[model samples]
Structures are given as structure tokens and as C-alpha cells.
Target: MIRDVAVLALEGSHAFELGVFCEVFGIDRSDDALPGYDFALVSATGDSVSTRHGFDVRTPHGLERLSSADLICVPAYDLRVRQPDRLAHELRAAAERGARVLSICTGAFLLGEAGLLDGRRCTTHWRYTDELARRHPRARVESDVLYVDQDPIITGAGTAAGVDTCLHVVRREHGSAVANTIARRMVAAPHREGGQRQYRERPQPREGTGSLAPVLGWIEANLDQNLTVEAMARHAHLSPRTFARRFQQEAGTTPLQWLTGQRVLLAQHHLETTDDPITAIARCTGLGTVDNLRHHFVRRLGITPQGYRRAFRAPHNK
Candidate 1:
């Protein structure tokens, strides 16, 4: 549903966050059955905008370009820099008109300046969550999550999480199939739950203790099995309590939570690529039954399994 995409190019904007928006929406991928967006880089100043890296990006579009945008990004900028009030006003106007306004990293501050974060559950980078809360006290700052999707106002946490945040919008607007295709092309994870922790002590397992790396691969390969924390703990040669603690430390979420997210992802793929009924997918994904499948599909994707298949079933399968 989102076609017109515009990102603000402000002075001292973080290059990577700006590139995240450009990568997700700006590129034309129609050859891969994914169409590009009507994208623009809008700046409050003139065509040339300086980045934090000391490079300049030229974008002829200006603030007025935001008027027709279905999605607008306030990409990360210097946290200390003061943005123009008019920019904030335009962002508010965009939200009022039902356009989704997304903020990556510290860009949430600009949204706060626009009064868009008030009464909305939002977030920023983990390091700045406290500051975001202190500045925008009315905003509910969910500090640790990768991103917070408050519908018309979406906020992403630090740098790489921007990819997750943008792909989430892509998934919601198009379907998991489109989002997954985009992810595959980018060589990124197909999906990461927005509620997943933004920070983790160990992204990979510690060298000495049994590595969760292999355990994760095993879990993925055997998703149809009835997996439990105790079972996983045994496989890791660890006590259940220790495994649970280590999982939280390493994965940034509980074991079962990660398991469910993986199950849902598999179900999404099945629904898109196969003609099998929901019951079959449920069993194959370890979701057990049609009722359970529908429950998770609706809860996680905001669409029923049947509806997802209808919208995103591959052309050959359909």
C-alpha cells in the first residue's frame, strides 16, 4: 500500500541509516517480482546536504515533496543538532493525513520535536533510550526492542535495526513473500520480530561453553519437531535453567519466543509457496493445528493464514 517514499536529507545525517532507506525502497527490483517505490530524497535546505561522514548528497526534492509521500523517513541525524520547526510541522501534517512516518535511530528525536511521539509507544537506540524518554516524557519508550511499530509512527532502534524496521513495513504492505524476497536479495535475515531485544551480550555463543550456533541450526532444520526448552537444553548438554539464562543472554529473547518466531516464519513460507491447507502447514511447522496456526498468523502478521495465502501465494502455486 505504500508506494510514495521520501526520506529527509538533513545536515549531518548518518550515512548508513540513509542508505538503509534507499536500499529498501529506492532500488528497482521488478525483475525479481518486486517493484521499486516512487522514492525521493527531500531536504529542508538546498540540493547539497552534508553527512556525518563529511560527504555530500545531492537531492533536488525539498520539504514540499513530503506532501504526496505515503511513507516518510527521518533518518538518523546528529542528536545534538536542532532541526527546523517547519520540518517537524510537515512530519506532523504527514501523520495527520495518514502517511506513515518512520524514524531510524536518533531520528526519533525529530519525531519528538514534531510532537508525534506524544502518547505513542516509541523507541530509539539502546544507548539513547533514556535520553529519548527524558526529552519526551509523554512518549512510552520501549527501550530494548529492535523497533516499535505504532502504525502511522514507526521508530527503529540503532543502525542495522533500520533494515528490520523497513522490511517490516514492506512485509505489512505487500506480504511476507515480498519481504522475504527482499531479504534474500540483501542476504539479510528474512524476518526479525520487532519486539526482539536490540542488544545482546553475545551475538554468537561463547567459545568455551557449548555454542548455541549449532543448536540454532538444528532447531531450524527440525522445526516440525515438538521443540521445548528442556529438549534444547539437553541438546546443548546444559541444565534447563542455564540454557534459559544463556539463551536470554545470547539471543536477546527467551528460547520459546525465538522458537515461535521461527515457526511463524516457516508457516509464512509454506502459505506462500505451497498449496497445502492450513492444517497441513500447522502440523509441518510444529504449530499443531489449524486453530493454532490462525492464532499465530493473526497475532504476528495481522492477517489470517488463509488471507496471507490469498494475498501472497506464488503465481505458480495459485
Candidate 2:
């Protein structure tokens, strides 16, 4: 349902973060069979805004453009510089009027300044989590998550996490198939578990552990199998305990947790794109029975499988 989109082009905004919004929402991708958004870059005074990287971003739009926006994006900006006062006030008012607001990296500072972070769970880049917490005492800033989605307010951790956040919005509003198509166009992951914790600043994986790409790919191809820790460990040529530890190191999640997330994602895809019965979808996704699939869909997405299909089934399928 998110059609009208406006990005707040604040002065000194980081170009890449702002570009993230543009790449996700600004482009005309209808040729690829994806939905097109009414995307615009709006500034405080309808003037050009200079980025931190010395380039100027301009659009014939201002804060007035936000009044009709379904979603507002705030990208990373220099925290040391003060922003226009009206930006914060209007943002607060927009969210009050049911407009979802998303922040990228230090952009969470603006939401904090607008008082939107108060009493809400949010996150920023790991390097800035402590600072965000210190600035907004009432905000429950989670340190390690890729992003935090508390309905009207979504916050991304850092640069690349912005893609994850925006794709999530598309997935939530449209359906997994649409989101996945958009992600494929961008050559990015269709989904990354938001709860997957941020890894430490390590240059490389620990000495003995090999890359996990093959194992992950194998897991996806074999989701219908009775996968267990021992089974996966053997495939990776490691003991169960070591495999668990190494998976945590490389993937930022336990193997089983990641497996469950993939199953849920697959089930979502089936629900949105296929007319298969719930039990059949469950069997294919390795969720076992209808009860198990419904339990996970409700717990993770707060919607029943049948409800999800009714709400999000492809137009052609319907």
C-alpha cells in the first residue's frame, strides 16, 4: 500500500545512504514487473542540499511534498551539524498522521531529535549505538541488530543495512515476491534476518573454519529435508559444537535459527505466489504440518498463513 514516497534530503546527508533510498524507491523499475513508487527528494526550503561528499542534490520539492507521502525517509547526515528545526517538527507530525518514517545510520539522530525514538525499540550503526542511546535516554536502542522495525518507525544500522531496511518495507507491504524481484534487480540479498546480530570488526573468519556460502546454498536447496545440527555439521566437515560456534561467527546466528528463518521466508513466498494448500506448502518448506507452519507464520509475522495469502496473494493468482 506504500505508494507515495518522499526522502528528506537534509543538508550534509551522506550520499550513499541517500542513494540507498534512490536506488530502492526512486528508480522506474516497472519494466522489470516491479511496482513503481512516487519517489521524490525533498529539502527544507526547496533548495539544493549539499552532501557531506561535496556533491549537491536538488529536486523541485520541499517539506510540502511530505504532507501526502505514505513513507518518509531520513538518510545519514553529519550529526555534529544542526538541522533545520522544522524538519524535526514536521517529521514528528507526519508519523502522528500515520506516515511511516525510516532512518538510516546517523539518520536515527534526527528521529531521536524529533522524539520519535522515545518509547520505541530502534537501532543504528554499531559504532553509533552507544551515542544514540546516550542522546535519547527514553529510546530502547538495540546495539547489534541489522535494523529494528517498530511499525511506523524503522531504523537501519549502517550503510548497507539501509537496503535491508527498505526491502523489508517492500516485502511487508507488497509481498515477498515483489520484494525479491526488486532485490534481484539490485543484485542484493532478498532478505537478511533483521535479528541477526552485528558481527565484531574482524578482518577474516577464524583460521580453520572455511567459507559458509556452499553450506548455506545447500541448506536452501534442501529445506524440505530433515536438517539437524549433526547433519549440517557433517556436511561442513566439522563437529556439531564447532559448527555451531563457527556459524555464529560467520552468519551472526545459530544454524537452526537461520534455518527456521529461511523456512519461514520460503513459506511466505509460497503463500504469496502459489495456490497450494497450506499443508502442501508446509511440507515443501519443511515446516512439517499445517499447525507448525501456522505457528511460525503467526509468531514471526503476526498473521496466519491463510490470512497472509488472502491479504498478499499475487493478482494473477487471485
Best candidate, TM-score: 2
Error of 1 at 229 (Å): 1.1
Clashing pairs in 1: none
Worst 10 residues of 2 by lDDT: 200-209
For model 1, residues 261-311, the per-residue Cα lDDT tens digits are 999999988887888878899999999999998998888778899988888
Q: How many residue-pair clashes does candidate 1 contain?
A: 0
- List model 2 lDDT by residue over 65-171, tens digit each: 99999999999999877899999999999999999999999999999999999999999999999999999999999988988899899999899889999998888
CA shift of 77, model 2, Å: 0.4
Report model 2's TM-score to 2 decimal places: 0.95
**TM-score, each model?**
0.94, 0.95
Question: Candidate 1: lDDT over CA atoms?
Answer: 0.90
Residue 21 alpha-carbon offset, candidate 1, angstroms: 0.7
- Model 1 residue 145 CA deviation (Å) reads 0.3
